[model samples]
Target: MLQSTEHCHIVRNSEILSGEPIIRGTRTPVRAIVEMWRIGVSPEEIPQRLPHLVLSQVFDALSYYLDHQVEINEYIEHNRIPDELIDPRVRKA
Candidate 1:
């Protein structure tokens, strides 16, 4: 699982995203992973899309989500853009 101290493999610190918890070194947030799983994406497919991540990390992140459901879910909800501002076609829009 991703310890709070362990930097995400995809999340980045951009002044724009309010420094939200992201996938690692990018603006992609951990929420994306949660959304993908919600949509039936297999754990194996994640690595193909995110070559930088190992399957273990992906699983670990999910485990982290399960263990910290309330905190992580709140983070996702807080970071979510409003429907009035986002395109519905976007993954988690």
Candidate 2:
């Protein structure tokens, strides 16, 4: 079931990524947006990469992240692929 957050564009559903907060009506997680921005992707270009999202959704996801840093950061860390799980050839230096 979908659950609404304080933000209008953000929501969570237990069936989706175990209830990770996501942009409403899409499976794209707010973390995905944050991660992209963290890696230097500009807001204007986010939708180009995540075509499913618009500028408003991208900005809202970022706003939600700011409001719930601890929660979202936990998800980020938990979802990260550990070095041991990385394939030898695919692992980053």
Candidate 3:
């Protein structure tokens, strides 16, 4: 594991996921957890959906999100596909 703050399970390394904050010891981005929660995935259900993570890791990801919403939200928006590029058939109403 990379050197991390004593109080949190989140870490960022330039070599990992392009330095996005992630759950320590894993490549799971904090944004992924935020997105899941935003879409209505409960904390208890997160681990079931992502078998590699535990409830604690999910919580840590969330805590990271709360501490850095702007950065993560920007990353999310930056990664979003433009509407024009979406196929009409797959676009949600």
How many clashes does each candidate structure show, in the order listed?
10, 0, 0
lDDT values for all models:
0.66, 0.94, 0.86
Put down candidate 3 lDDT per residue, 2-38, tens digits, no spaces: 5464437888877887888878888888889999999
Best by lDDT: 2
Candidates, ranked, lDDT: 2, 3, 1
Instruction: Give the range where candidate 2 is weakest over 10 consecutive residues by summed lDDT.
Output: 84-93
lDDT of 2 at 72: 91
Q: Cα miss at 77, model 1 (Å)?
A: 0.5
Which portions of model 1 miss their true places by more than 4 Å?
1-29, 88-93
Q: Is candidate 2 or candidate 3 better by TM-score?
A: 2
> Clash pairs of candidate 2?
none
Query: Which of candidates 1 and 2 is the stronger one according to TM-score?
Result: 2
Model 2: residues >4 Å from true position, as ranges?
A: none
Model 1 per-residue lDDT tens digits across residues 1-93: 322435345333646366555555445566677767878988899878887777776776777677667877888788667887876677462
